[model samples]
Target: MSARVAVLGLGAMGLPMATALARIFDVVAFDIAAERVALAVEAGATGVGTVVEACLGTDVVVVGVRDGAQLDALVLGDGGVADSLPTGAVVVVTSTVGEAAVRAVAEALAARGIRCVDAPVSGGPVRAGTGDLLIMVGADDEALAAARPVLDALSSSLTVVGGIGAGQQLKTVNQLLCGIHTAAASEALALAHRLGLDLDACIEVLSQGAAASFMFADRGPRIAAQLRGETPPLRSRLDVIGKDMGIVGDLARQLKVATPVAAAAEQLYRTVAAAGLDASDDSVVATMLAKEPAW
Candidate 1:
């Protein structure tokens, strides 16, 4: 029989990942939002109301919460799934919470004979539904093998970085570049707009040349659209990127590394938040930079 998978936190990434997992496994999904749960059911997963209900009888529990606090609350805190999950069941953590947080949760779960797979994912929500994400894994051999099918189903490029906490570490590195590149893209596009360059053409040229980066390619059009006063759909949220950049900052501080450029980008995200765009798409940062200086 195929392994039964329980997916917790059916938000942007969770909903789509559960949809993909339902195609190959018996997937049970849970989210606080009733609408999201309904959407999960529409995608062929059995939607439950609580974490405990989702965990019971599952061979693997996949968590896609937003942060360490939510991860703790969902897995080990009040009304969490730690006790509900059977011994030897694997918990696949797909969030980008920092390495220390994952390590703490892993240790707690291991005490109950539950295996934890630190497998933080990238590639946004669209690729998640199509099972084409890039997954960075940090788990021992047995735990990795146990979660392999689910990981394979969700990832086009799955890399095992190290054992427990390493995936978060690698993802921190990823977010550092992502945060900086996004800030750079915003500034560049904002400058283009101020200089009377056609943003569409400029993005095309930059994306094909030495200035090309995944972030430039991915967020450039959205930045251009924002400069044109059009609201792009929220593909990546400012708050989420802000959270990731915060994680990068924390890691850099802990390791005593000087990342001046990333620090500047992090500050720009904060400025975007202060401008009352915290809840907006991250592309909105471009608008902030594109404005004429009052001085």
Candidate 2:
């Protein structure tokens, strides 16, 4: 029989993932917001208005919500999916919540006879749309095997990291590096403009040279747009980066690791949020840097 899958929280990432899974499996898409569910339904997914209804008959349930609190509400609260899921159904948590929260959820689900996997993803919305995203999976061999089809639908690269919470651990490292690299890209481009170098030429040369990164290439044009007072369409928002970086900070503290660079980037994102650009694309950090005197 074909696996019945439910994808919850139909946001930018979740909606595309659900659409991709629907192409290969029988999918029930659920979102708290009616409009998002409606949109997914229009895109050929079976939309369910409630989380309970979505999980009732699914073989695998993917929770793509924002953070730990939202995850808790969907899985443990009144009318939650945890109470409604079939005994052997697997719960795939694709949110980038920290290690502690994921582990706790896994334990809770285990008590109720449901398998939980921490399967946080990366590669941004563009990759998500193309089904070429990377999934960092944290589950045992059996759980990994059980979720392989769903993972195949969402990712071109899937790594089965050790055990419960390992995926979130790796994702914390991902956010730390991404936050720092994004800040570094802004600083580099802003410095080039101040030095009277042709900004586009500088980027063209340097991005082809040893200093290039995914962040520099992807955020460069958006940064340039923000400098011209035209914001690019949001792929990842400043607030989302800030939240992920905050999780990194929390993880670093728990592990007693010093993360000065990540902390600095966190401050920049905090400033971006305070400037009321939280809802803007993350590349707007370049605008914040451009406002400084050319020195």
Candidate 3:
């Protein structure tokens, strides 16, 4: 029998994932923005108005919201998942809302006998569209078993980290590394420009050498474009990284760990966000770094 999936939040990541899920499941996608719902229809999902409508007859609910607060509002507020989704339905929280947030959501769902899975994803919208995402899932064995097929359809790599909220904790660490690598890439390329090296050659050579990383290979060309005054299409936005880095900051501070380099990278993203480039692709940090004063 084909599973019925309700996908909430039709943003960059959610739309693609919902579209992909529609291939294997009966999918009804919902978003507050009517325009986004229309887009989901074009992408193969059945679009709906209310979150409650999306939940009707669905066995699994996928949450791909922007942040913790958004997730909370959707699952806990008026007309929310807690009040709407039927008992025994599994709720997969794919938003990278850190540990505490996912934990609270999990606890709430458990109260109503709804299974919750903290399956925070990596890779951007493009990957989500093709089921090439890396999902770190945090759920007890029973919930994981119940949600496995749904997770299988969405991710190439699905690792069960531990009990509820562990996925977000791991994703937080990923953001720390990713933020630092992105910032480090920008810092390097900007320095190459300042040193009068042929930037084309610099990017080419650096990307081939031991200095190359996944972030460098992936974000290098875009960073190169930013250096030349061009804006690349976003795979992930500046404010997304800024927001993610902020999550990292919160987690690190709570753990009392010293993260000097990560802190510096977070500040760079914060600066870019404050300068009104929040909607710009995160590679714009290269431009910010290339400026005389940088950040």
Q: Highest TM-score, which number?
A: 1
lDDT of 2 by residue, 9-41 (tens): 887689888878878888899987899888788
RMSD of each: 1.3, 2.0, 1.9
Instruction: Please give each candidate's TM-score.
Output: 0.96, 0.93, 0.94
**Stretches of candidate 3 exceeding 4 Å from the true structure:** 195-201, 293-295
Q: What is the overall TM-score of model 3 with all chains considered together? A: 0.94
- lDDT (0-100) at residue 69 of candidate 3? 93
Model 1 Cα lDDT, one tens digit per residue, 20-78:
99999999999999999999999999999888889889999999998999999889986
Which candidate model has the greater TM-score, 2 or 3? 3
Sequence-dependent TM-score of model 1: 0.96
The RMSD (Cα, Å) of candidate 3 is 1.9
**Model 1 clashes, total count:** 0
Task: Give candidate 1 misplaced runs (Cα > 4 Å).
Answer: none
Error (Å) of candidate 1 at residue 97 is 0.5
Model 2 vs. true fold: TM: 0.93
**Candidate 3: which pairs clash?**
none
Distance from true location, Cα of 113 in model 2, Å: 1.1
Ranking by lDDT: 1, 3, 2
